[model samples]
Target: MKVVLLQDVAGHGKKGDVVNVSDGYARNVLIAKKWGLEATPKNLNDLKLRTKNEAKLAAEHLAAAREMAEAMKSWKVETAIKTGENGKVFGSVSSREIADEVKKQYDQDLDKKKIILEEPIRSLGMHEIKVKLHPQVTAILRVHVGEA
Candidate 1:
């Protein structure tokens, strides 16, 4: 029996995949558990249409990511820190702080996790930060740290 998987089946097939299984297993396990559907002509055609739509949406998301990356290259964020007489910062700046500052100052929301900081900022100066916007897109942002 030919079956179209609705979701991934361990050691079997992935979602939207067509595979041949024994008639008894297809009727008893796959269909009974709603893991897959019979690969009728209508179901096959629907799968093709869904795949096409998914590809289009993925392309649109990539384009948006690229645009955001370009915009970020020209943007700069400023953060304030408390310092002692010797100019040593009290606490290091975190990615969460940078993300919040960007949102508050630039009116754009950015994920803290996406703000890749190899090490927390401990000294006051201009720093470059890398932001992973997407799998294929990365942006470098300038950050200025000043005493408060």
Candidate 2:
């Protein structure tokens, strides 16, 4: 018996996959448990259409991420830090501060979690920050840190 999996079944197949199993198992374990549906002609066609729509939506999301990365290259955010005598830095700059500064300066809302910071900025200079816009897209944002 052929079954279309509604969810992943260990050692069997992933969701949306069609797998062949014994008729007894398909009828008792899969259908009875509501884990899968019988692979009828209508069910197969619906799965095919759903897959096609998902692929199209994924491509559109990737394109939007690429476009945002291109636009972010020219954006610069200004931030400030407190410095002591002899030019000693008092505090470091964080991703949350950078995100807030970008919104305040450029009117662009950016998520702090998307800003990748290996460590907090401790120096006073222009720094390049990596922002993960998507799984496959990364953008560089310039941040100019000066004394407050």
Candidate 3:
């Protein structure tokens, strides 16, 4: 019997995949557990339409990410850090601080986890930060550190 999987089934196939299984197994396990549906003509057509819509949505997300990356190149976020006597830095500026500064300055919300900071900023100057907007898109964000 042919079945259209609603979710991944180990040793069988992934979601939206059509796989042939024993009639008893399809009726008892897949259909009973709601893991899959009978691969009738209507179900197959519905799956095709859903797949097409998902592809179009994915393409739109990629385009938006690319546009954001380009705009971020020209943006500069300013943040402050405490400085001690004799030009010594008191604390470091982390990814969370950078994300907050960007939101405060540019009114753009950014995820701290997406801000790739190998080490905290410890100096007072301009630095280039790498922001991962999407799997295929990375943006360089300029950050200026000043003494608070």
lDDT of each: 0.93, 0.95, 0.94
Residues 20-74 of candidate 2 have per-residue lDDT tens digits of 9999999999999999999999999998999899999999989998998998999
Off by over 4 Å in 1: none
| TM-score, per-candidate, Cα-based | 0.90, 0.87, 0.91
Q: Give a tens-digit lDDT track for model 3, residues 15-65.
A: 999999999999999999999999999999999999999999999989998
What's the lDDT for candidate 2? 0.95
Candidate 3 residue-wise lDDT at 128: 95
- The per-prediction tally of clashing pairs is 0, 0, 0
Stretches of candidate 3 exceeding 4 Å from the true structure: none
14-125, model 1: which lDDT tens digit per residue?
9999999999999999999999999999989999999999999999989998998999888889999999998878999999999999999889989999999989999899
Comparing 1 and 2 on lDDT, the stronger one: 2
- Candidate 2: list runs displaced more than 4 Å: 32-34
- What are the candidates' C-alpha RMSDs? 1.6, 1.9, 1.5
Deviation (Å) of 90 in candidate 2: 1.8
lDDT of 2 at 147: 97
